[model samples]
Target chain A: MNYPNGSKQIPRSSQKLNSNETIFSNRGMTLEEDINATNDYYLDACLAVIHKKPTPVQIVKVDYPKRSAAVIKEGYFKQASTTDYNGVYRGKYVDFEAKETKNKTSFPLSNIHQHQVNHMKAVINQGGICFLIIRFAAFDETYLFQAHHLFEHWDNQFKGARKSIKYEQIRENGYFIPFAYQARVNYLSIVDQVYF
Target chain B: MNYPNGSKQIPRSSQKLNSNETIFSNRGMTLEEDINATNDYYLDACLAVIHKKPTPVQIVKVDYPKRSAAVIKEGYFKQASTTDYNGVYRGKYVDFEAKETKNKTSFPLSNIHQHQVNHMKAVINQGGICFLIIRFAAFDETYLFQAHHLFEHWDNQFKGARKSIKYEQIRENGYFIPFAYQARVNYLSIVDQVYF
Candidate 1:
């Protein structure tokens, strides 16, 4: 199994933890947390200016009480039209969506939406860096799969192809993103090697 | 007064409307709506992939019904750390905040926040195209003011300078954006001339 910081050994104290709990507790973070921490590191070092867009919520009603801030009384989550994380890196527009799946054999297409794919296509057409960060939690592995490569599978799915990308195929075509102490998901390294 | 689509005359039906009401009613849209429409035009034409980010909200409670979608019970608007709109344009990272002021004489510095300035500073340092779209509603004029020029005024406010940028200064330093039929706030025209 892959370990964070490239350390193969698990700490002795956590050896008794349940395997499922260990997936998160051992890593001390989820995929979202890891990416956020990495983005913070990138921002602090003046290396990039990436940020996760706020969750889209449709506000229906708001109450403005005297001497208090406005409070939303009714709201609902809205499906995002674009990727979750996006920003500028090295003068290029960078955009990507991060996902984590527990499946060991493959990454399912159901986790993504058509609009997000369409948005990624538009970004690519405009010459932006676009990709997906897929984490196979069962194996504790994360991969940076470029948008163009994903499009091939995404289109083939409608023509009697598998609804998911096999883990082996991902290993062959995607860049394995290594975890670091501070920058947990160092996807920019892959971007540097593949795009720059 | 400036007219949309470069027509000098106001429509006969709108001539009798109160001048203040005409600012929005006659224009039939706010600065935000105009910009959103312009972005849509750009997106439809595959010219750019810019979008205004969803409003930031701090959710406190949510209710999941038996069969219906989850609904947020309590939420509060959060001050955004970055600019309102950001996306890719001509293979470059573009970031900007749009603001409209009814004040005829100046654009107040108080309309902006320190954190946003810091965010814009970071974006500019990353070699991205950064600017502000300022709409002086009273004058029926909109201008594209580069972020660096705004930084000068933003910094001066702390150094015993006026807290507002005079209208004349903006007219002299900013590029006046023309209004089009479909692309109401055709700020990209100014972007092409100034940045490209």
Candidate 2:
């Protein structure tokens, strides 16, 4: 079966969602894959522009096999210097990080790195639209939290207010990113309501 | 010498440049290092905000040596889906790709792939700034050409234009990115000149 170049294929993999099905059993889709499909749909519909940050790798050895795709035999992961998913929407720069949490009640700071926090701050400083799309998978809910609010809590992280943001706090601070059949994570609608 | 963390010190390797040595003996500075230093200066001086796209990778195996850091034991290079550099400059969103060409006469279409071309077109369609920076190493000349021109040439590939863009044609259609001691590529100067 063609995976449709994105994670949406999980739903299309079979007519029924069952515990035994690999698609149903394996979290169905990762946050990254969902965002990828969402971006593809956005590109197709011309609503807004965004793309996932590339995986950071240090290429050490490349194998050139004739009549086949070049296989990277050896490489190392490099630290990312910026946040993933950035582009323009209605003339405003849109930048964000997508994260999923198994916890039903909160989003964890441990799930984020300091570098990512700093990168989002930098994006906000540049007159760009910056936010975080967080998914509480257990609750099957996603929230769009603006960078300023995220940093506010992050600033208080040293004081140990909360390691992860509570669902209640997120509900107060973030806009709900409604899911659609075509655009799975339609955060731009929230962006239009908030940043734009 | 410190080589961006985790890279072992190889005992004054022959390829190691003096602190001030230019890279490839043509661009005056390695693209990665110069982009970092330029970003540092940009952050310090509050100039237009721009950054090099993070290196892309696919992590296959990772060892959690300590909670603070994960040692990536195995990974592969994933094809990049976007340009090499992008950010917000003033109020405009900026995005671009940087490439070095050995061919002195023309830039080849083989250097770019379909996905990247689609990404650039999407960025432009969203009203963001997009372009490519080409370094003709033989002549030590750098040129910034808009993605539209690239798309046009690439589209014409089916109609049977030259497979590559001539250096003379590039000179006519593209702007020469000024060399700078600090910024190196200094492509933003040309952005201001052309776009602003």
**Fnat for model 2?**
0.53
Residues B1-196 of candidate 2 have per-residue lDDT tens digits of 1121233322111345678875433345555565567667776667766777765766777667655555556555567877777788776888887778889789988888888898888888889899988877776767788899899999999898878888877878887665566666666777776777
Model 2 per-residue lDDT tens digits across residues A137-162: 77566678889988988889899687
Best by lDDT: 1
Provide the lowest-lDDT 10-residue window in model 2 chain A: A1-10
Q: Residues B1-196, candidate 1, lDDT per residue (tens digit)?
A: 2232433433232346565663432155789999999999999999899999999999999999999999999999999999999999988999999999999899999999999999999999999999999988776778888999999999998899999999888878887777667788887877887778
Alpha carbon lDDT at A5, candidate 2: 22
In terms of DockQ, the best-performing candidate is 1
lDDT of 1 by residue, A1-196 (tens): 2332434433232246565663332154689999999999999999999999999999999999999999999999999999999999999999999999989899999999999999999999999999999988876778889899899999999999999999878877887776566788888877887888
Worst 10 residues of 2 chain B by lDDT: B1-10
Docking class of 1: medium
Task: Give Cα-based local distance difference scores for all models.
Answer: 0.86, 0.73
Runs off by more than 4 Å, candidate 2: A1-27, A59-74, B1-37, B58-76
